[model samples]
Target: MPRSDSRTRRSRTRSRRGVPLRKSLMVRLLATSVLIAVCSIAATAWLAATTTSHALRQEQGQVLARDAQVYDALLGYAATHRSWDAVAPDVASLAKRTGRRIVLTTPQRRTLADSAAADHAALPAAVSAVVNPLAVDSSLTGGTGATPIDPRAVGPYRLTAAERTALAASARSITGCLLKLGEPSQISYAPSGRPRVTTESLTAAAPVIPDVCGGQSRILTRPTPTEAAALHQLEGLVNPCLRRQGMSPIRIGLDYIGPQSIETLYAPMDAGRITEGCVEDGRREQLAPYVAPSALLFVTGVPGADTTGFALTGANAVRIVEVAALVLTVTVAAAVLMSTRLIRPLRTLTEAAQRPDQARNRVPVSTDDEIGSLAVAFNDLSARRERLEDQRKAMVRDVAHELRTPLSNIRGWLEAVEDGVAVADRPLTSRLLREALLLQHIIDDLRDVAADDAHTFRLHTERVRAAEVVEWVCAAHRDAARTARVALTWSAEGDPELTADALRLRQAVGNLLSNAVRHTPPGGSVEVRTSVRDRSVLIEVADTGSGISDEELPHVFDLFWRSEKSRSRLTGGSGLGLAIVRQLTEAHGGRVTVSSTLGAGSLFTLHLPSAAAPPLRRDPAGAAKDRRER
Candidate 1:
């Protein structure tokens, strides 16, 4: 019907039509479930593959470590022995410890020893390493840039039982002397039974050897007869090379410290290098006959074990795909069911909202979740709206009835005067003025109530004495009480003060006093009391009148409400006095309450916020009088 209504309807229609399937809650939920399922499957497959690959690498690494151990054991055996005659027991022990097949062969492929000979297992074509004492594997021996010859190949340098015992005793003596000098040292024997004095400081360039221990060093560092003979032979071989290089011949000792040569001072740095090369060559030649011949070392995995790398078979891959598909289907199905259950209640709410009769339309609350709570709250809001609609209708009727009565009286009096049937005398004029004033009062009360409803009611707040406000209102209404032959009185407990609108406070108190004076019988009394209670100033007006019933008490402050259902001005004054009092009290951030009993009186209380009282001023004359007494 209206342009805005047409536009709103069109907009709603467009929104409904424009919604796509992908944007739907159910579809999106299904998509999300599928995506999560896919990611989970992919992650699981990746983790499994990665973990398996790592385990395989670890297994390969362990196999390599065992192979190196076998190689090292065999190399040490060959280095010390002239032949492999006693190597069978050692080979079998290494194979048992390492869980591998160990086979040693000559360069001609003649099997020297085999741990798997009883099984008759053929040798692996590829060799693992070479067992050579003359040319050793430095990596296996943990050596860096040292001699290629294995240190175990001591040959003639090996000390006899007597020589070893003498060197050990000498080493113990040196260690004891070093400890007494506050320099701790330990005896460490080399492969040749040469006991050297080692300390924590020995790793440095200049080792600190105490002078007191010098005699012990001479005993320990002196080469034994067996080592002396070998060293003498090695020096003979090394001296020939030194002479060929034109460097002075140097004497060698067990410590390998040669005297500095003055003849080689002008030679290049290779002069020392040439001496080291000659020594290395001489030792290899001298020890060559004492060690076993070099041979190939063949180390294989556990007999009949799989040695190929890891691989995923075709069947396993198919199984993984099937499992992933199954997971996806179940996830999507569960998402569909869950989204449907969640959307069902929401659809019910939407349909209920779209209906024109909102008060009657209610969604069934079948759950205790947030959605069910929303339904309950919506039903409560609908009930409140219905009650307010009824109140609005009743308020319109009451306002009309209140305004029509005074208007009818004024019209009737004017029509009588114009028709020449009544005189416009002083008494008649006074009655007309009273009726007009009554009408104006009703209009003003309605305006104030409307202002409160619209939240525009304002109060100019100030600090006023509560006792004064109560006494002034009572004095203003005293004449009315006298005319009605009702006794009116006022009292105060203390000088209670209030932070409030003085005018509004008075108007509220006056309304209560006037109402009490009007309702009370001719001989009845109206009393006003002021006191402080709970940080609030209480101005209570209690009247000895025909009291309100319990049924009417709740609606006493309701606008356009009166105890007199007949709506007569004689019994009640426009049914708005108490309502205006409530509005004014609330504007000052205060509250008014009434308690009444049938056949007894009603007490109306205005509880306003209390203010601190001003300090009392001292009298100058009283101060002088007290001073003279002191």
Candidate 2:
């Protein structure tokens, strides 16, 4: 009774687990999809709100890199010209290329050249960079200002054609000598327009020649007359200035690439302060006739955007929010459409399942997706249920008919005795007892079938030698086999130890043995054999009997089913033996199978898992109870 209640509880539990408690599928799908869309939209809006200024600054950085080249071009023009008077065209070109307004002015804030009309009020407040070729304000150098002199415009120090030819000849002579001595030499030009003699073999001994060819110093300064005159004037201006500052006067070197590049008479670091204003005055005084005066370049947009500004505005923000909302709505719509399509089949299945008559209902599979696969599975389940229902009905009728015959026989005999129509003698009493026993046997078999279907059958599993079970079953059925005039034999080979329920195992094996012995004709043989095969224990019963036909073989394990559709005890017992055998075997996690020929013989094999067969191992009662609980 407890086992029956457990089975009922399990059935209810399974039914409860199949249903879910929450919103409907469509609502959940729409909620999840809309949430994701909303999160994405919110993230986009947040990023725009937080990073607009940073993005604008990054864009400005890229513009700065691009305009660095244009700045350098304009600086070169300023370096080689006398003033910004003719610079309007160049400034306009630079503005066009860089997509920015360009304005040039003197250090005194006087406008020099403007890409647009001279409207100083429209320009930005700060200067972009200074344009000074002589005493450069390093910001305009673009990090390549190793020398203050613009390398492209090398004023008076630039090499003439004759000077280059003379230098190249000298370099070739050095190259020839180095090559002869198995060394390397090349002539390269410096940005200052000086020929530099280069050699790969620094460790080699120098050739016997003039110091100019292979010397470490590459610059050979030959100042022009104009440069000489400028140097004299610069020295004259620097002495008085230094004396006024109370710093000692120092000797100067004029054979330099630029006006500020003075070879020092004192610490070079100290010379910067002494020559600060003096160098600027001297370079402009020297190159006044040669190049333009220093000017400040400014780049600007409209008045309000003098500084960097955010890219997002109120209208843009509204548009972004609108687009985000539209996306969320579309996503929700898609989720609803998809969920509706997906749940249609499930609803059909649910309706069919709710019907009282299940034998004729099936779900239609329209697609090959997971939902469609579920529909296919539902249809298969419905068909299987129909077949089982038919089998159950037939089994009920068979049980009724089987009990009716024996019951009628017993009742008739009793009634005859009661009416004094017949004597209640020993032979008559024995016949009545046999009829009662047959009824008892049918009832017991029906109970087993019910227990098996409910999955409440108990198995007291333990380590038992399979050979012992076989011997016990064979011994129990030995007398019956002898009475039927059939030879009963048993044999065992290999280790046949396994974990199994001993009473259930015996019942299942005994059923096979009994069936085999009954079917075997006189002078036939029934053998019970136990062996180990592929980590499993096999208990087989072979019989030389009236074997079953191919068409009727598959029905052998059905409840109360017989090959011959009759309840004749002479040819067939109550046909529940094989069914009980299968149920008990499966309850112990084992399998029973049969092979038969029409007339030759029949073999029934029981296979049980024996992978963990240990010698002298047993399951305690506690462990068995724990297993049952699990």
Candidate 3:
């Protein structure tokens, strides 16, 4: 149970660990950008489909209207003459006029004036019921006991009577290609025809003559009222034939197939947008000649328009669309994934830069790219740091050796003084006292080095006047400069103001000046200069003294190190002068560097970083304290 509790605690702890990808800036940006891309694609597709549907419907309406005009003109021509032979020739003329068959059927359901084929058995059923009524009805009308030929005859007879009235109203007394129907209960076939006086009954067993209309009267027209405007719609979708004489029949039903719309209806093709809309509107329309339908004419009543019908309904367009959408989905997914993969490494590198203890300890990456190069560079840096640590250790050893020699001499002189080995008033006694002070100063310098390393070297860091510090150091060093016969001059520029511990900065600057004065031969001059350069302030101490050797130049600031320690016997100076200079300058967030030559003497440059003030921070030891307390 304890172990299980520990596991549960670990899981709960992980839930609170750092930032999650869902919360990260980069992840949120990635998701938002990808969603935008998806929405743009879908919206564009809908707009394209809507626009195309509107265009096709507009163009279709115009084609259908033209076909109607042609059909009406042909009928007018046939009503002027009373000949059956004339009907075919006129029908053939009209067929040539609109480049489509002009079929005429008699009331007997027999072919009378067909422009194409008399053998076509696909005559519409509604036409057969009207134009070729039952033989029982025919016998009933003529039988003596059967329902008398009364004017009150209704049902089919009433329907026929209404049509006859319409036919009579259409007859032309004055002929300039007009319809004429004199004898009733009949349908005639004469392309250029007049009303027949009373023809012998062969097809309909009576001296019953048909109405002469538009050359040949059609009791049941090309398309019943049910098929009126659909014929034009069919013409609009018709395939174009330059000859305009072939039967490119598209039997449009709920389930009928040929080369589908995308395959043949259009001339040139683009698979870019195949299936436009869905089966939410899946109705079939027999647009027999959808291509260049100007030559076709269909006289039909509007078939009950299934407005739900879609033009591109076949599996071909749907398949194409499905394939395109699938490819698009995959492409989008792949692009997003690839993009994420590319950024993942960069994000890792950024995290590594922020938390370098984790970053630098890892092995160098293996890749032939810039990121791999960066890893190699980091490895080189880590190695360099290790070497510098080794150098710092060597410096510590060197400092100890330098201090031990002076300390030993100081201690031996003190022990001898206690034992009264030296005679009273001896000159060596004065040197011995000075040496003891040097030893004490060196010990203090070592303490400063340790404190600097620990970052616990406290300073009353604040804004102080640099001019005041410089003047005081110069005044204190007046006696030494006079003893050395060196003119030590000081100058300040701008405000000579800076933020630092005043005492520390004064000590550091004084060390540089004193070091320069010590090295200068008699008549040699030391000048202290201060200036504000850009955002940083620079303090320089230059002298004409025997300069440092190239070999010892770099180690000038090392603790307890001095090129000429014996030269400062009167002042009882410690080799810690330059070392203290470096520590104090650094504590103020400034650096001290020396430029020297074999004979031209040294110039120490103090470069201070500009800062308004240090940021307020909780003591770094706070976290350690908390951990210890826990």
Q: Tell me how candidate 3 scores on lDDT.
A: 0.52
Which candidate has the highest lDDT of all? 1
How do these models rank on lDDT, best leading? 1, 2, 3
Question: Tens digit of lDDT per residue, candidate 3, span 1-630?
Answer: 357346434433443453455555456557757865676576557645654565456545543444444444433332222224455676667556554444555545455556556435354554311111111123313334221111111111112345444434433221222323233333342111212212232222112212333332342222223233443343344433211434343332211111122112222222112211111011122311111111222233223334344455344356557656775777688668856855766676676566654423433354434444455455545444544565668667766665777778877777877799855466776877767676677677778766766657888877777677788889999998999999989899966577878888888988888888878889999998888776677888999999999878867876556786553454335567886787677666666788998898888998875444342333435422321221
Note the Cα lDDT for every prediction shown: 0.75, 0.69, 0.52
lDDT of 1 by residue, 386-442 (tens): 556667787799989999999999999989999998899998899899889989989
Model 2 residue 68 distance off true place after TM-score fit, in angstroms:
28
User: What TM-score, to 2 decimals, does candidate 3 have?
Assistant: 0.39
Off by over 4 Å in 1: 1-318, 420-423, 613-630
In model 3, what lDDT does residue 112 have?
58
User: Model 1 clash pairs?
Assistant: none
What TM-score goes with each of the models? Answer: 0.51, 0.48, 0.39
- Sliding window of 10 residues with minimal summed lDDT for model 1: 258-267
